[model samples]
Target: MTPHEALDDLTRRGLLRSLKPLPDNRGRLVVAGETWLNFCSNDYLDLGHDPALVAASVRAVEDLGCSAAGSRLVSGHLDLHAEFEAKAAAFLGFEAALLFGSGFLANLGAVPALAGEKATIFCDRLNHASLIDGIRMSGMKWHRYRHNDPAHLDELLTKHPAEAGETRLVITDSIFSMDGDAAPLAAVAEAARRHGALLLVDESHAIGVMGPSSKGLCAAFGLKPDAITCGMGKAFGGYGGFVATSATLAALIVNRARSFIYSTGLPPACVGAGIAALDRFAETRGALGDEAMALAKRMHGLLAEAGFEMPPFASPILPVMVGDNHLAQEFAARLAARRILCSAIRPPTVPPGTARLRLTVTRAHTGADLIAARDAFAAVARELGLLP
Candidate 1:
């Protein structure tokens, strides 16, 4: 079909979701707008619009100017980028790190670079699309084990022959984004170790929200991977993504990762802002970050009591399961009308019949906000005949 026809088809099928412009970051949705009470963002720490972050970015621009101008392999590597990389690696307890324009780029660059023809990439079934895409794009034998099931991973590893001289790399999201669930990393790591395989983790969701210093699930659980990819956009409240690993692995990716080599490096301002965010995250203990978790826990309890089927998780990502797609869509729309901006995540993003409201809590939300959201959900549920 032609591009115009394809666009029309998508709109007709309800697959096209339009964007409504926002004024500011009043909260998770938008501030100073007709809409309010945003539960749709990945801003777990509510630091996205933090004055400190804004000031830091401004300072970076004044101090470092605007752009990095080219790829890091060319002339794009700035001192600020180097500073952020070093600080990030140190904060996460890794030997070295490489920054990418985005978390998507980090996964896209790292996966294919690490996995080749002689490599088998074992991934969790519920990994983010970037990871799945990366592996598929790598031309490696992509294997999917059941989500969070180390036993399944072991079974896959055991069935493969060691004489093939192929290396096995196990990959998973430290926290599953859509389901709000964590992988069994300790078990998966152990299984990988037993089979002489390398383990790679994408801590896009768990990095700045979990652990003692928010060093991510690895530091929180003391399970370091062969490589760790995380986004600064979400909890770090900044822009860019990074991969922390050993110097050797770092060099290999720098040499071969197409996503990294082709894309222009992140702007100097963003790099400096990332450094500032890392500094703040380092100084701000996990205790301060725990506010989002507390709110999530509270939301979970209330939703459970109110008969909302929530996905099991130990993180701030909270899902309110609604079994039907149309019902989920209607509920989300009605809730938004009440100024509670939750999103209905449906199939292709999530599995069919498991449609949900993927509520992301942040430090910015107050008790009143939570109460308002609770009441709004209850109201919408009753109106939709979802709640008895």
Candidate 2:
């Protein structure tokens, strides 16, 4: 069958998915012309709609106009971008940083540029799609280890020690986005160091959520600056991504990373917003301590109490494992009907048979909100015969 026929087959099988439109109003996710309580968004801190961010964005447009207008190598580079990059690098304890328009592009740029033709990349199985794509783009032979299994990575390295001379690279997400679990970065780093391999971590989820001062997993684990590429949008509550590394590595990426070199720089508004967000993170760092973790723990407990099977993750990305795609979709739809929004994560986004309702808890949600969410899940599960 042709590719289009395969797509049609997927649609017929109720597997094809489309975007759900969201409205402009606060906390409103629009689906079928109705607003619902959003739980599927990655806006963990709920900073996406913060008044400060909005104000900063407005001021930026007023001062700097709309677009970056050209690629960074051409005329797109701006003083705002430099300031933001400098702040981000310093915050993350890196010598220098390079920004890309988006996290996806940053990965695409850095991964391939750092690892060349003869390099071999060892990647974790459950990493974000961007890292997987980056590894593929790197044109290096990549071996996938079982999710968070440092032993598998060690085995791969031991079996193929010959590839070490060709810039052996091991890559993983510091926090798995879908699972909401922290990676064992120390173990991974140890294995990398043991085999003289370089570690590349994408701390997209943990940059502003985990670690002291919202630095990231590398800081949490004391990994060197050269080990990380962070997405500013997720936890930074802003736009763009950066490769935070030593001066030499930063220079190399700036010189060779095509995505950063060729694409339009991040917008001045986004730069300002990012800078503001980073500053906010630093100022409010103490507040992120136990409250966020406590909230996540409470949600996990409530879900488990309601007999929902949650995956093992300490981060805010809580997954209620439903095991069946149709049921997962129905569960999400039922939640939506009740004005609580969640999305059914099915095949391609997650492995088959692991379809789940990926609910996120934020500082914005209260204890009562969590209870309501639990009640909703329980009601839906019981109604659907998923729970007794």
* lDDT of each residue in 70-112, candidate 2, tens digit only: 9887899888888887988888878888888889988998888
**Candidate 2 runs further than 4 Å off:** 2-4, 25-35, 163-165
Error of 1 at 118 (Å): 2.0
Segments of candidate 1 deviating more than 4 angstroms: 1-14, 28-35
lDDT of 1 by residue, 240-353 (tens): 999999888898889989989998998877887788778777888776567778888887777777777666648878888876777888899998788888888877788768
Clashing pairs in model 2? none
TM-scores, all models, native as reference:
0.95, 0.94
Give RMSD to native, each candidate.
Answer: 1.9, 2.0
Positional deviation of residue 205's Cα in model 2 after best superposition, in angstroms: 0.6
Error of 2 at 366 (Å): 1.7
